[model samples]
Target: MDASTVPGILDQAHRRTTAGLLMLVTFIAFEAMAVGTAMPTAVAELDGLAWYGWPFSAFLVASVVGMVVGGDAGDRRGPRVALPWGVAAFAAGLLVAGLAGGMAVFVAGRALQGLGAGVMVVLLYVIAGQAYDSSLRPRLFGAISAAWVLPALVGPVLAGLVTTHASWRLVFLGLLPLIVLGALLVLSAGRSLTAPDSPPPPARGRRWWAVLAGLGIAALQYAGQRLDLPAVPVAVVGAAALVAGLRPLLPRGTARVARGLPAVVASRGLLAGAFFGMDALIPLLLTSVHGYSPTAAGLPLTAGAVGWALASQLQGRFARVPRERLLRLGFVLLAVGLAATVLAAVPALGGWPAYLTWAVAGLGMGFGMPSVGVLLLEQSPEHRRGADSAALQIADVTLSALSIGLAGVLVAAATQGLLGLPAAVAASIAVCTALALLGARLAGRAAAPPRAAVPGAGTTLAAS
Candidate 1:
């Protein structure tokens, strides 16, 4: 049985703390799903299709900066200090996005929003790791997964409705109340946070991290946006910038996606890329080909919500589950889900099959994401918690940016017909998903932990 099921695995204080933190999840989901749905309209009306990938890409690239900032902030000020700043920054980004009239301004808003989301997400993970006992972690992770189900169900539809009937501007504007509410809840738990056993970060050199992180994400995202520039050259440059960014943060082997820590980080990137890449493609395909209206097309997203929720519930229920098994399960579901999605492009079953596949892929991710968190926390040093957490996001956002950018390229090239977009999307995702499965398997089979990275690009992150 899970510890949470026991009479007192959580004290009153812990329950309050859990309640407070969960609010963050709820708002994050709302923001994520709504932004996604509203984006199609935002770009179409704003005449930002030329930069359609920017808002998402910018957020992802900026998230790298947020990770560095959040890690440094968490190490020095604690999650309490770092988290609110993240929330406030994110809210400000939304405001910027809501008001932007042009693509450049919109991109800037996304960059800032990315920074905020990255910081808040990692800090929240840190808080969850620190606040709960080991035995209770599964339930916590499960709940985190469960949180997505609702927003998945409601968020896209709401965003679609808002976009069709009201205003896409409201998509950003509407998030204000929930964001405010969630932050207040976390703030209320301020007194209960325990101290990290590690000393705070060395104060003098910390500011440079912000610049490094920003540059790193910008370069990596640019590489993703421009991948067809000869695969070797693109990989060479992309690899270089990615390594440069990692120099200070992760362990050495991680950059190569090596045996230990590198593999963990790589797995995170691969899976996230696979999921987000598909997500970036879906609305485009549905609206362009199936004659579905924006609101109607968003139903595929809801399928993901269902898959994520059900799978998360199972992750928690199955207590003896190994980290390896969790990891493997994640890849399998993802591969299967993608396969289902790929089937959509096959032209035999028509459209509904594609929707089914997308949902399955989402469920795969819900099972996988929290499991990765469990692995990272189990291995992280308390002092390095912030850095490790940030690295995970860095991997996710970095890969996601690349994947989405590539998807965009495919859509542009394949614009000859309606079928072209889905075909390109499916093909690109298939490559990433297959690669992700291999990475996951290697991670599960490895006996030793990942080694710590020296401070340099290609610096490998140590497996905990």
Candidate 2:
């Protein structure tokens, strides 16, 4: 049946899949949101002041490799084969990190979690492509985005409270049981999914490239932590490796922001880089510069998340409003929010402004992020959905890492007395704001010709 005649996502036919998917996303979202709040305390306790960014960088680097392998597996044997392994790896990583006493072991566990998250998240797109119709896809993505809401509202605060009163270890250890439950639900719901009839293209080359990309990011992260001249050579090498690695992994013309799928892919990177680059630093900015407690530091994140969820729901409800317009608006808001957030760095302005500024940025992401997913799926050929999904995610992770690393370098400069903390933070926000504006400029390129409408679902948006 076409989407118009199909049951709604929460209806009997789709209830299990929808529930399973949302449940899984929620758990992941909680972990992601909570990590930022707990990280400072965790690093301090472990006595790893210089290694602050390594945990996050390790996760992002490992995720690239995971996405490559997971995409191949999903294409070959479907989500059934890929999903379980991803869950296993993620669980193992959490266990390791939770039990660790040192920074090295903690980072190692985070790497494993990144690998598992990479695999499972790619399969989510694969599953959506396989099981849902075009019309349903928008709603699915919207719901997926909304899954972050509850986590956003409470995850950071809860993490902060737990880290303060209890052990930070509980933050990692707490999620293990929930992970198993989500996996069981998704696996059971996905039992009917199967691989394509034809063999997929060879993934060997892509896998190798992904590894190279991971190494490159790791090098860059290392360079970011170092303030001396020795970091220059490492940064150059890392840049070269990253460029080489991304050439084959992303869509053709992605670097140049070519129209259609290439632009869509590029947009994801830019948007992610702009948003997450600032996100990872906000808590640090507040606690270090403004003297906010962990719980207080997490409030702005909650505000952003709330904005994201609300905007996603509205976009989903008004699915026919033209996704490109929403994307453009999203970028504008993100740019504005990011730029305004710089005010928080100035002691005269105070830290309260972050809540509002970040909320605006979150609204932008709420609109932009899901629209990108829907557009990609709409443009992707059925057989190549896994590969394309991998590309989209690769862009998100790669750009986010680069942006975060850039901010890390600035933070290092501050630590080493080369610049003031406020200046470093402002500089990082400025860069991210520019990226959001770039995304706005390229948003139209992601559009396609409108498709024929379903009876009451309304016309699909396309480039005029």
Best by lDDT: 2
Model 1 segments beyond 4 Å from truth? 1-11, 39-54, 99-108, 203-239, 256-260, 286-297, 416-423, 445-464
What is the C-alpha lDDT profile of model 2 across 1-464, one tens digit per residue? 67768767887777778888888788877888889789999899889878888898788788888888888888888887778899899899999989989999999999999899888888899889887777787788989999967787888778989999998999999999988888787777766778888847666888889888888888887898788899999999998898888877787767887667777878999989999999989989999999999779978988898899888887777678777788898999999999999989998777889989999999999999999998888777656677778888998887888899999999998998999999999999999999999999889988863444222111111111
Q: For candidate 1, which ten residues in a row score worst on lDDT?
A: 454-463
Each prediction's RMSD to truth: 4.5, 4.9
Model 1 Cα lDDT, one tens digit per residue, 1-464: 45555443246656656665676777676777778778888898889788786687577667767777887678667787778799988889888989999879888887878778878878877787777766677778878777756877777778888889999998887777777777776667656554576656453343354455455555555555553556546556665655555556655556566654456666788788878788767766667766668766777877877888787767766668786577778888888887667665644555677678877787788778777777777766677677777777777776776777677667756874544666786778777677567656675742235444323322224322
List, in order, the clash count of every candidate structure: 16, 0
* Candidate whose TM-score is highest: 2
Error of 1 at 28 (Å): 2.5
What is the alpha-carbon lDDT of model 2 when measured against the actual structure?
Answer: 0.85
RMSD of 1: 4.5
